[model samples]
Target: MAVNRDKKEPVIEVQDICKTYFMPGGMSQSVLKHVSFDVMPGEFVAIMGHSGSGKSTLMNILGCLDRPTSGVYKLAGKSVSDKTDAELAEIRGREIGFVFQNFNLLMKRTIADNVSLPLIYQGVSEAERHERAVQMLHKVQLNGYEDRLPTQISGGMQQRVAIARALINNPKIIFADEPTGNLDSKTSDEIMDLFTALNKQGITIVLVTHEDDVADYAERMIKIGDGRKVYDGLRAEYQKDEE
Candidate 1:
């Protein structure tokens, strides 16, 4: 299905976002400072920064795992910055998928069970959940592994299982944070290739990474420096500028 990009609203919108943590003795630290960006439907964007540059904090906000101290955040055209925790959880479950650096699969569960875990929260029937899990596993090319455990698979395969689980909900967007951090170079390339294929299918992707090679997989790059957005533009252009 082709997405009409011009007619669709942005999937993510952040304006003048800021986050601060108050410390003991009347001190505070600002992690994000007036950062702003928009991610259109079907767009693939990579957020990059060194440690302590606030990229992780920004990702947490973007993924609805945390809220900014100040500023507006709109997800799929709805203001979410002020939403209650329950509301944010509902939104996260319904509209967003997450792929983390660690696979985050249950070690004791079957691959199919791990993939279908989200559906249990939605009160889906076990049979239907299993069916959908099978379908998602197929989508990730993990056929015939549904009955296996995460420990039985390679790191790359475990990541594939995680991706399949993310897709089981059919979210409008996926937030991947250092998705290839645990893999070897070749495996990392394979995982990035999978992400690229998913992006081509019109699923919006927001990835956070510090590695230039991983960021290269995205078309656009948003670079942060010391709590502020330092650059935002074509990934290739950013590389050229660096060169």
Candidate 2:
């Protein structure tokens, strides 16, 4: 389904966002420079940049993992730019889901345990956590493998477990950073297909990748260069305009 940009309010609003890191000797390096954009509900957006282009920094700000040095960031319409670390953690728990490139799972833990890990922080009971984990595994097509350890699964299946874990919180938005970085081409395609299915179900996805093929999965693209936004529009149109 197409996103209606006019009628519904954006799920993410970033205005003139900027980030800088200060060195010990009063030296500083600016990362993102006055970047801004909005992502409507259910929109599949990809953020792209080469290394040192600040895409990861942008993702950190959007995911509430880090605060911007300056500028406004609103998630679900409320400004989160000034929220405290604790407040941001709460918001992240309640509103954002993250899937990392490394598939950050506990090696010794069972698949179900890993998927249910997020709920432990929310004070959810063990029984319910297992139940929800099973449900999420089923959603990711990993139903019967819940008892297996992460070491027992293929790289692709492990990523599925990561996706299941991300879904356990029923987040308003999902941030997938280089989600297919370790997978083979076929597995990457499968994972992107899953993301596409989820987006069709009205889940907002913000993906960050440097690969053109990976970025192609998203309907819209936001490209950054030298800490500045160089492009924002339909993914297909970006190169066409450059050409």
Candidate 3:
């Protein structure tokens, strides 16, 4: 859907974003072209695409990891197109929390330490960070696993820890890149349920994955192919096609 960015409020607005890269062997590839989308303050959206569908490129732009080759991006009503690298990094750290498919936990660290990582970067006091991390772990239903290393837990439990770590700092939006990609169906369902619960508590979520099975967890889904959006709307339509 085309979001009315000129409306009174929009947490994230992108106008005609285009991302291209120069591949080796004297070839340039366009991954995203004139892509536009908006994410409201508390919306949970999903982006679905095939391997080369440019979803990852869009995720990078939305998360401010890379600037668009040409186009405008506004975050929290402020234009972010011209931010310096340091400035962009600051915004990313403050406004966004990222969860990856691999769980991205530190094996040597306990669950408490992993959840404390983001706050530590923000300069929170060590004692307070530990306390907040413990709280977040509890929020994700990992009440008594604070001392467990990443390897000591099941894959699903580790993902919950990752989710807790993402929420420890209470970011405005959480970007999950194929969060359940590595888990079995049962485990994937559990992880998606956690996402649903988080959304209920008002954290905007944007997930990227090629698997429709995973994307079904979100209320809205956008499908892409050949670097352009093919569909964007309720999941019911995609479900109909599946049937």
Q: All models: lDDT? A: 0.93, 0.93, 0.87
Tens digits of lDDT, candidate 3, 205-241: 9999877777878888877777777787887667545
Global lDDT for candidate 1?
A: 0.93
Pairs of colliding residues, candidate 1: none
Clashes of 2: 0
Candidate 1 residue 17 C-alpha distance from true site, Å? 0.2
Q: Give the distance in Å from residue 178's predicted Cα in candidate 2 to where it truly belongs.
A: 0.7
- Arrange candidates, best TM-score first: 2, 1, 3
TM-score of 1: 0.95
Looking at model 1, residue 151 earns an lDDT score of: 98
For residues 1-243, write the lDDT of model 2, one tens digit per residue: 997757888999999999999999999999999999999999999998888899889999999999999999999999998889999999999998899999999999999999999999989999999999999999999999999999999999999999999999998799999999999989999999999988998889999998889999999999999999999999988773462
Residue ranges of candidate 3 with Cα displaced over 4 Å: 1-8, 239-243
Which ranges in model 1 have alpha carbons more than 4 Å from their true place? 1-5, 240-243
- Among all windows of ten consecutive residues in candidate 1, which has the lowest summed lDDT? 234-243
> Whose TM-score is higher: candidate 2's or candidate 3's?
2
